[model samples]
Target: MLGLGAPELILIILAILLLFGYKKLPDASRSLGRSLRIFKGEMKGMKDDDVRSKDPARTTPVRGEIVAPADPAAELEAEARAAELRAAELRAQAERSRTADGPR
Candidate 1:
């Protein structure tokens, strides 16, 4: 719709046909149609959902700094530290077992 007319559309289609050949055009068109249908359905659903949700308080904007979610990096570092501690404990237990099993 953005300044595109029938002639421009025809030219564009011909360009695509030249690029992808005739055999693949049907599959490409089918995929494009499905995507457009899905996009249209999603937009309609969002519009309906917006209409059904009309609470004034919900619409009101918060006037403070939004707190960010917990850092994933910190969580990963904590998990790594816990794993290292567990490994150290296992090594210490193994050392004790080896010492006890050795000849006096």
Candidate 2:
């Protein structure tokens, strides 16, 4: 497409074949096809969800009188806790890796 003619395309394909080898190309292609299919399916699902959200009747009705609107302070506090947990997990992972690598 990007100013690439048939010869350029052929050259690129040949290069890829050389890099990956013919024996593995089919498996790689299958994996790529499956990834594309999954991507398309997720995109379609998001679009359907968007459409459903736009229709009021599609959503569940509130069970009772709505409480006061959500507090931003509480949300921020929850987010901060989640971030701390993630950081702790990452630190643990790094420690494990360092131990496994054995004083390198």
Candidate 3:
């Protein structure tokens, strides 16, 4: 609908036909249609899930061990410490390797 007229549409169609030969066009269109159908189905399922989530009675209760509340700052600090440890370990390994390879 980008203000394209019949002639422009025809030209575009011709270009597509030229790009993808007629024999393959049908298969491509079929694949595209199937993808679109699957996408629509997924979108519908997501919307249904959202609706179910909004309705407490329709939602499933947690069955496993309850998870603790997230602590963003503490989690980040822990991750940073782990990364620092890994970096130190790598540096030590590299230093050992370099010393072993020295004068060789």
Candidate 4:
């Protein structure tokens, strides 16, 4: 591949062997093989996900009902409740500080 003939490939391998030595070559090759396999598997999974996403009938929810917007009144009520909780916490903190300061 990439214009590398058999002679060139052999030369490259010999150079790598000389550089890394015989002891580390097997470990390097095994790590390279594992990385390549993981890369290939991830690419395959991404392609499958792409195909599934493109097919609306396969990826879309079966119920097919559109969600309605949240009620503004309900949201406002929730905010008011949160504010009340914060106020209660602040009062409790003030009471604790007053007690700690001993009648100050």
- The model with the greatest lDDT is 3
Model 3, 1-104: lDDT tens digits are: 48999999999999999999999999999999999999999999999999999997666758984655468889999999999999999999999999999966
User: How high is the CA lDDT of each candidate model?
Assistant: 0.87, 0.91, 0.92, 0.90
Residue range 37-74, candidate 1, lDDT tens digits: 99999999998778666865345346884745468899
lDDT of 4 by residue, 1-101 (tens): 39999999999999999999999989999999999999999999999999999997557555977655458789899999999999999999999999999
Error of 4 at 53 (Å): 0.9
**C-alpha TM-score for every candidate:** 0.43, 0.56, 0.58, 0.49
lDDT of 2 at 99: 98
- Model 1: number of clashes? 0
TM-score attained by model 1: 0.43
Question: What's the CA error at residue 14 for candidate 4, in Å?
Answer: 1.7
Runs of candidate 1 with Cα error greater than 4 angstroms are 1-10, 55-104
* Poorest 10 consecutive residues by lDDT, candidate 3: 61-70
How well does candidate 4 match the true structure in TM-score terms?
A: 0.49
Rank candidates by lDDT, best first. Answer: 3, 2, 4, 1
When 3 and 4 are scored with TM-score, the better candidate is: 3
Candidates sorted on TM-score, descending: 3, 2, 4, 1
